[model samples]
Target: MNKNIILIGFMGTGKSSLGRRLARRLGYKFVDTDSAIEEITGKTVEQIFRKDGEIRFRSEEKLLVRKLSGQSGLVVATGGGMVLEQENVDLLKQNGVLICLRAEPEVILKRVKNKKRRPLLSRGDLLENIIKLTKERESAYEIADFSVDTSRLTFDEVLNQIRKFLQQEGYIK
Candidate 1:
């Protein structure tokens, strides 16, 4: 696993969880950019959104992604909205293979229903919001080298699928 593997998707699509497992399976380092931001800022994502706002958080996110791009043998799990910025997508693609983990709006809502950590989903009508965001970001996500549907898959299943994809793509021996 020499190439960096970037995981992009909406919230609750298993980017962080699956990224960690995939990294372990591939003998690579796992870096969750959202966690990296929290570590650097000393704040939870919700708090960051409440205090510094989404713009500031996004700026930090971009920097973290840029930094991660220079690293090798790593699996990077990005925030749901990270790919909204073209620069971030370019940076990720430049240094690695970008894989988009996609899930239906209903599945995503169900998975994230009780997760208060996500600021964007704090309001009512989470399903609607998710659908709206999905529609808006679908094009950006489509730019990924591969896409994995995570709606009905377990973590291990998702990891296996990713492993197969990497092998098929010749990214792993």
Candidate 2:
């Protein structure tokens, strides 16, 4: 697993969970880009959004990706909106096998329903925002090398699918 396995997805799509498990299985480092940003800035993602606004948070995110591009043997779980920008995708893909995890809007809502940390879902209407954001990001996500819909699958199933993808892509033995 020389190339990083970069997981890109909407907020509730299991990028972080799967990335952590994949990293453990492969004995590679696991990095959640959002957590990295929070660590670097000394502020939570919601704080960044509330205090400085999303543009600033995205700027921080871009910087993080730029830094991560120079490293190796890590599974990167990107923030939901990371793929919204083409340049982010380009930089991450330069040394990573980018895979997008996917799920239905309803499924996503169900998963994130109780997660108050999601800044994007701070709006009053959860389901509506999920539908709108999913539509907005679908095209960008389509650029991934492969897609895994974890809406119904267990984590083990998701892991198997990702393992198979990595093996077929020659990233793993």
Candidate 3:
């Protein structure tokens, strides 16, 4: 498929993992926006958040989103807040299908609690933060072309669901 497969979701929703698997399965290049930003800025995501702050990080993300939106044959795993801006969403959809991955708040906490990598979740109550952020992004996530809840689903199962949607949409055979 020439069109990009764009994965958007809250953190810890398996975007990177599933994007890599889908890219390999479809023989497409895989790009994680966070990693791309890190590469460009010469810093980890946490460093960017802690040092440069979210606004500066988002500026970098917006630039990368514009770049990725012009390409084809890609499986893009976008950062959790990338679509918060309408411009990012419009640009990404121009040459791609936006697939949102979702999970329960508790599931999200279970998935990311051990990792200190998530800057937004580093604040007070982890579960409360997840719920608040998820709620805040609900509208943006709703604009996705397709959505899959990864909660309680195996990796293979979630992948299959995504694949089935792509097939039905004629993105894959």
Residue range 18-117, candidate 2, lDDT tens digits: 8999999999999999999999999999999999999999999999999999999999999999988888999999999999999999999999999879
Instruction: State how far residue 87 of model 1 sits from its true place (Å).
Output: 1.1
Q: Candidate 1's residue-wise lDDT over 1-173, tens digit each? A: 38999999888999998888888888899999889999999999999999999999999998898888888999999998999999998888887999999999999988898888989878878888899889998898898888989999888888888888889999997
Q: In candidate 1, where is summed lDDT lowest over 10 consecutive residues?
A: 120-129
For model 3, the local distance difference test gives 0.95
Model 2: lDDT to the true structure: 0.93
Off by over 4 Å in 3: none
Q: Estimate the TM-score of every prediction.
A: 0.96, 0.98, 0.98
**Candidates ranked by lDDT, best first?**
3, 2, 1
